[model samples]
Target: MSSSHDTHAAHDAATSHGAHAEKKSMRLMLHVWRQRDPSAEGKFVTYKLDDVSPDMSFLEMLDVLNERLIAGGDEAIAFDHDCREGICGACSLTINGQPHGFESETTTCQIHMRRFEDGQTIYIEPFRANAFPVVKDLVVDRGAFDRIIAAGGFITARAGSAPDANALPVPQVAADAAMDAAACIGCGACVAACKNASAMLFVSAKVSHLALLPQGQAERNSRVLAMVEQMDKEGFGNCTNESECEAACPKGISVSNIARLNREYLRALASSD
Candidate 1:
């Protein structure tokens, strides 16, 4: 048997080490959605990650987990992320029932591990919607958004160079409104946040951004019509004005844009006559 002095020394050392470890790192219980493919059924799988640095971004934490998984001969969790600077809306994850992890004006890649409590359970999953089918574990096909943009989200007016300052002068209010709408990165968070899976917020942002500008006048009517048509054809649910999308938007996109979309649609219909 160990001597009493040795036992006391070992116990003190262990207690000190535990305190140091607790102060420097964190342990998280992650309930992540696992899916093999689009057709395969997905379910939540628990994973315990230890020694996590609070300074690490959410994606970095995932990176550490994936490194361990790869070394352990387990399939790594697949998640989308790009421009970890948060410019790209590629980090389309729903964290703890909130899109982009409950941060105001932020993306998933911008989420820091420090926001979570030590040993707290985190629920991570892909953006759910009929239009956004799961491609793999935590990866969903957001190509539907690209299609909507391609349909009529551009202006055909050729711009060889910057226009003269006085040329095509726009109202200050309209210019500011257009810029605000243009901030949308098309991350599809609005759709994920809505109970009905509506893409109105996304569509409205695009429409409002262009429609408020003078250059966009040429195709304003057709733009709204074609985009809305394609949106419906893609199986996105209709907006019932629940405003869930606005609350969940990372860019703080307002629901007023949806109202603008409705007005634009009606105006387009009347112009068709």
Candidate 2:
């Protein structure tokens, strides 16, 4: 591997900003979670990085460390990331026991080095849950989420062309609620932060987004049932009405969605009976 600069980048997708502004060298002690694979026992391995740019994103700092590791003939830390943008939610990491660190409404990719003290120790770990088993260092298998979505996260209604914007008249309140739920990126931070490892927040967001829209009404009854069933089958614990999931959520998806999910589920059950 080569340096993370000028073409031979270690992780070209990862990004940082304002490298020249407020140039301060940050020395950090990183106790990062390390696991070879799913069957391997995971542990926190300490690595010290000096002269790090305060402008670098958390992943970019890791990239710099990885470059150094490669140059020194050591194994590079493995973590999941794509699009460096927070929208993908691919760069999920538990920072200092919080889902995406102490920052509010921020993803791991959006966390910059400036958020921490110059010589502080930071703990980085993969999001933990029974369904999201560790794949490697700081990377977990979040395929259970994909499975849940696959079970019934889509509407089967097909259209030949784009409908007019005014064709469907949706109430502003419903539209707003659907938009709020649609913000979920499936990061699984809520699961990691929850003591019960509940995925209700994630599931509820997925369910409520569709249920509030008219286009989603066709399969609305079955969607909730199938999704909740798949969620249970994936070993995610039930929600105990704890708001930790919402508090940990990077998107700030409301717990109200969970209430909506329960209502949807009950309605589905009654309709089935």
Model 1 C-alpha lDDT versus the unseen true structure: 0.87
lDDT of each residue in 118-204, candidate 2, tens digit only: 899999988889999998888889999999999986687666698888988899999999999999999999899899999999999
Clashing pairs in 1: none
Model 1 stretches with alpha carbons more than 4 Å out: 1-23
> Model 2: runs farther than 4 Å from truth?
1-22
TM-score of each: 0.90, 0.90
Model 1, residue 102: distance off in Å is 1.5
Error of 1 at 111 (Å): 1.0
TM-score of 2: 0.90
| Model 1 Cα lDDT, one tens digit per residue, 132-217 | 99999999999998899888866877677998989889999999888888889899999999999999999999999999999999
Worst lDDT run of 10 residues, candidate 1, spans 1-10
